[model samples]
Target: MPDTETPAPQLLELARSLGVATEYWDWQGEHVTVPEGTVRAVLEALGVDVSTPEAVRLSAVELDERPWRRVLPPSVVVRQGARTAVPVHLPHGTSVAAWIELEDGGRRELVQQERWVEPRVVDGGQVGEASFELPADLPLGWHRLRARVGDAEPAVAALVVTPDRLTLPASVAGRRAWGVMTQLYQVRSRRSWGVGDLADLAELASWTGGDLGADFVLVNPLHAAEPVAPMEPSPYLPTTRRFVNPLYIRVEAIDEVAYMPAAQRQLLEWQAEAVQATNGDDTIDRDGAWAAKRSALETVFRLPRSPGRQIAFERYCVEQGEGLVDFATWCALAEEHGPAWTQWPEQLHDPRSAAVAEERERLADTVELHRWMQWVVDEQLATAHRRAREAGMRLGVVHDLAVGVHPEGADVWGLGPALARGVTVGAPPDPFNQQGQDWSQPPWRPDQLAELGYAPYRDMLRTVLRHAGGIRIDHVIGLFRLWWVPAGQPPTEGTYVRYDHEALVGILALEAQRSGALVVGEDLGVVEPWVRTYLEERGVLGTSILWFERQEGGVPLRPEAWRELCLASVTTHDLPPSAGYLAGEHVDLRARLELLTRPVEQERALDEADRAQVLDAVRARGLLREGAGEQEVVEALHRYLTWAPSRLLGVALADMVGDHRTVNQPGTDEEYPNWRVPLADGSGTVLLLEDVVRSRRARSLARAVRTR
Candidate 1:
């Protein structure tokens, strides 16, 4: 029995603080249109019951700290400025202990211990008796208390301890690590259907970490995108960021598929050849590869799941419960909305409406299918992570967390009210583009994220960390500020919106320490210099590209000056590969495309001289033979990167094979074949994974940096 009247202003404020840009929401209406699938995703994020008719409420309710579980690491809460007892709800027949862990100068010691009896509540709930104490002498920061019953057991009825306040210390050190970047999709493998998958990632990690003695391998985001016919090719513009794309799943490695009946096996095996066709020297056909795998998975899922498989699936379902439901709902809504939900039906419009619940129940099968896909993707991703670790990767499975999701995608749909509908995030006009660029994706409001305690951010981080040893935060400057273009406005009309830098860095540090994963920010633009210093103090690493690692006076900083914690790469997704850079293909392409802001001839002349100097520097470092040619000079540049003192180095998959093309171009989408090209060798043919590993180029590069 909840009130159905208009939500209070405070609620609206909460929504706004959480990045909600709308005062009211109607899912099916014109003003507040959201893809049906996106609505479901929002609902799922809030842990709403899809089958239930009641409109699920999304609120963070405060209550007396209660014991929610009775396992080890029992949750507890700390009161502000006082050592006190706050009664909390608990499950019946659960044992608990309460104690506070105090921190002083980086040392953690337990204090203020108290035990309590289980109390019976009149409202048919159990409560814990007595309160825990806090030290008056403790300095301010996040301190936690634990109510525990068992060691090494899942938490049962424990209260969640949250400190009332904290004062961050000033002298935080910059990270002392580094990583390399790679494009998995471009990292073609012998076994891959057409594009790279987790298997290829595992292989790269093994070589880079075990052989090259690198700390981490940074990479492009692998977030799930719209799985429609003729799928959107760009990895940056994903359908959903919370889930992995099923297209990247390694089907041949599935345990259930391996145990399938002979007839089923034969049917799946028949499709392997078609899937393997892309593994040859051909441009990647993403749609064809996914089509084959999707068909195969549907059949594999149909066969009765084994007990062990059932257990795993059930566990996955439980773990991904609300998130899965929402994604599925969005998938269905995307179908109903077609191109955009802004033009969808009125009655079924609002994400929090009863109409959505009804539609969700009516379209149960479709919703379930989306959930199944997520489960499979999660499973495969986890398997890949495990394999990378087992293969002796020093820091396995460094994942790429994209800067933002597509405007019409799941994240935007779920937080429509919070996200500004008319504003799209992008970069200001730079030397490269006279007319700035608009990414067409909504960005989170800084104030909104703070008020919400960064729950969405936290949840997304938790999810991504599941299959990663570290995470590369793409476009890291977004955490400090973002260039926002008002909807319908030109990119040039955009203004910079500032973010909560302190909170952003704080939460990031907290999450990183919690996950035991290193944080590398892609700080590669006209960023505020203090931003890097701040990130460093917080133990977060900055991205350092060799091409851009120059001092104030146009002098290149020595390798030792580069921070060890930062990731050093020769190029990025938007840049040309090593071969292309050395061969002057990028310069030629830009000149041909008229992308240069300066005179074409002048730009070309300057670029040629710059390229020559870079090659000369590589040769001087002994990275190349004295008389090395252009391609060999490119190899030498890579050798310089691999041997750099930086902790992590990302060798783009394209660079590993001497591929020249850029995987993605920022300004031009259709004008240039962005994200659609394959990783090719010299002579312009696609390079197969097996063939790549067997090639002289790969061997030469591998041998050059096989320090470990």
Candidate 2:
């Protein structure tokens, strides 16, 4: 199904105009031309008419005339202190006046600049372009630029002036901040429902900050999954990234639970008892746990709310506006007709249709329940942040932002045209993953985002950052470009689609500055070198792992050589803990999952050499002895992290407890227990949050990372 034939010149030109790459160098340093079929398919997903040559020419004509058709450009994003020139198009000899409405209700008139470009005929009329100088002193906030030509209604577009670089929060302004990185679902406490909950998060943050002197607790993305059984286990493959998962709710902690009648209390207690019994299992049982918890949540939802609580809930609903309503509507619809909107009745497929509106009114009660759940999640998360801060945590909870949403999820159903259809986001072939990867999540269409002024992206950021002190953007490179793998095609057949990074990243910086939250971009894998520099310049930190930080000759890079603006860690969630890595558990696990490209022994030997080289560096740096024990070596690895000048240090909770099991493996889906591994040590003993706090090994590793 992949057409390797080169595209015609006109097709190539149109592709380039649409930000599609015709050719790119792979991670293996080989020039690979993107399949022509892939390019055409991606264009089709972006709403281009590419069914025939005639259609292609018509699409190209539309693209060429797009700017001329606009009175003002869709949006203008500029850094504070930088003057920008924006173009305005109008019919020949038509006079216009343009001005900027500042965020604080202030106004500034735009100065027109003369340009000599020839007019072009668009839609049977010759259109001329004029340039306007946007002032350098424009304040940093979301503003509006307005223009009126020939006494017509004023044309307007968004005007955003973002900070050149984000300002660091007080806690991390002048010193390094170290904290625990963990999968919150696997971090069950004694009091949580089978899986970890917000209550567990608060307790962990409080203990880590109060006793361990940690600054923040970085957890996996707690994004919402399906509202029914067989829910997705991987947090990264969530239904929506903008909202919190209701699965993490602590049923007993809800205020209404305390006020329930005796019969209701007995019923909820039964549900809680059923779910809590699975807490000590070897693997996380999300479906079974969610079933019990969902029933309990339904019981809680039925309880009456006090007038004050009702007012707060209503206020939250009003503040969230339409996005919240639509998300809740999706949830109710999913419960009735299943999560996949594609399989729903054809009339209901269009979320904005009259059919959906009628359905929304019919399911208003269920929609209200979902909305209330989000409000409860907000309250509980706010409580966690408060507890962390009260315990002296500098940054408190640093949430994760997953790259994209599920194909049939809420965002895909709601964000309609903003995201491209029929293509999924993934990676091109690389040495590590020879077959490449297909993450079945639709990517945002850059052109549509500009047309819509990026409202969906901005709103998602605001919601996530509301209760978080920081956000780790998974695959932040996606803000610049993404690999678009067309449906029914392998990932290797995909091509890159460039986004307007200057606009996307600038908005992120603006949002982070407003929230007073730190931004860390996961800059791993094959990245364009300047992307890292750009992110750093925007006050976004980068991620650095111990094993991946190697020189061209394959020697371990010294900690001193690491970037100052990074989160340096010995191991991440994808790999086993430091102890397991030393023992080659990742290689063996890969072998078991059949993910290895070579023989197990060969992979194991290569892995050993890599580990030995790192340990040798650790010894040379005076952090370890010639014959250190496993625990000592693990602690020394963390000590190696402390040697880096990086502003942030992350010590995995798994490593603190000598966990040999990895929570996730990159290449394996169902073959490996990815995202299901409970918090455990080398002997396969499941450990609780409290168990981690009391462990001597955990305490020693914490001290090692804390050492300056």
Q: Cα RMSD for candidate 1? A: 11.5
Question: For model 2, where is the 10-residue window of minimal lDDT?
Answer: 427-436
Per residue, candidate 2 scores C-alpha lDDT tens digits across 1-708 of 568899888899999998999999988688888777988999999899989999999999998888899999898989999978998999988998999998999999988998767889988889998889999989999999999998899999998899999888977999999999999998898776789999999999999999999999999998999998779988998898889899998888889888999988998887777778788999898998888888888878888999999999999999999999999999999999999999999999888899999999999999999999999999999999889989999999999999899999999999899888999999876645667889989999998898888889999999889988899999999999999999998888999999999999999999998998999999888789999999998899999999999888999888899999998888887778888888888887778777666788887888888888998898988889987899999888888888889999999988888888878888667887789989987788998888988998878888888875
Report the lDDT tens digits of candidate 1 across residue range 200-259: 877766665565554456667788877666677888877667788888877777777777
On TM-score, the leading prediction is: 2
- How far residue 561's Cα lies from its native spot in candidate 1, in Å, is 2.4
After aligning candidate 2 to the native by TM-score, how far in Å is the CA of 531 from where it should be? Answer: 0.6
Candidate 1 regions with alpha-carbon error over 4 angstroms: 1-180, 206-215, 336-339, 619-626, 642-644
In model 1, the worst 10-residue window by lDDT is: 166-175
lDDT of 2: 0.90
TM-scores, one per candidate:
0.75, 0.98
Q: Cα lDDT for residue 339, model 1?
A: 34
